[model samples]
Target: MPKVLNITAARSRLTSLVQEAFLEQKRTLIGKHGVPMAALLPIREYEELLQDLEDLGDMLQAEQEYRRTGGKDFEDVVKKPKGRR
Candidate 1:
């Protein structure tokens, strides 16, 4: 689990927390009034997460397109040369 810090405490140790995230790949959670609100993680992880979300979106779009097109198999749409079985 990540270390949780309230807004006041996070202000004082922001530098150290950032260092931990960058150097050690540690995560930190920040909260206000005891309700968790934000997090700090390495930039690489954040970028990968964004990429994963984009890939998922692309998959969803492809699925919708397939359904709209009556879900024909790729091989069925491509023509084969005669005697090239």
Candidate 2:
């Protein structure tokens, strides 16, 4: 489980919180009025999450393009007989 801290308390312990994220690879959830508002996590983890989102977006775009093109493979279309369009 991640460590949870209200904004006030987190402000007082910001240095240690940053160290925990960098060295320990731990997440800290910052909350306000009992609602989680943000997080502190390792930079590498954040980058990986961004990459995953990009990959998902690319896959969805490819699916949409395939559907728009009537699902014909590009290679199959190219290999058709010369007179057939």
Candidate 3:
């Protein structure tokens, strides 16, 4: 679990928290009214998360296209006969 820091305390240690999260792979959960509102994470970790989301979206689009096409492969749709120029 990530360490939780309320808004005021987190504000005071923002620089150090960034260092901790970025250099040490630690995570800090920032909250207001004792409710988690945001997270601080390393840049690389955030990029990986974005990439995972993109890949999942691509898979969903492929699945939907497959259902619409009744499992026809994309190559089959674009392939030409041997005699074609």
Among the numbered candidates, top TM-score falls to: 1
User: Sorted by TM-score, highest first, which candidate order results?
Assistant: 1, 3, 2
Cα lDDT for residue 14, model 3? 96
Clashing pairs in 2: none
lDDT of 1 by residue, 1-85 (tens): 7656899999999999999889999888999887779999998999999999999999999999999988878798797878998
- What's the true lDDT of residue 19 in model 3? 95
TM-score of 2: 0.79
User: What C-alpha lDDT, on a 0 to 100 scale, does residue 74 get in candidate 2?
Assistant: 74
Tens-place lDDT per residue, model 2, 1-85, is 5656899999999999999889999899999876889999899899999999999999999999899988978798779798878
lDDT for 60 in candidate 1 is 100
Model 3, range 16-61, lDDT digits (tens) per residue? 9999978898888999877899999988899999999999999999
* Clash totals in order: 0, 0, 0
Candidates in order have lDDT scores of: 0.91, 0.91, 0.91
Better of 1 and 3 by TM-score: 1
lDDT of 2 at 42: 93
Q: Give the Å error, residue 55, model 1.
A: 0.3
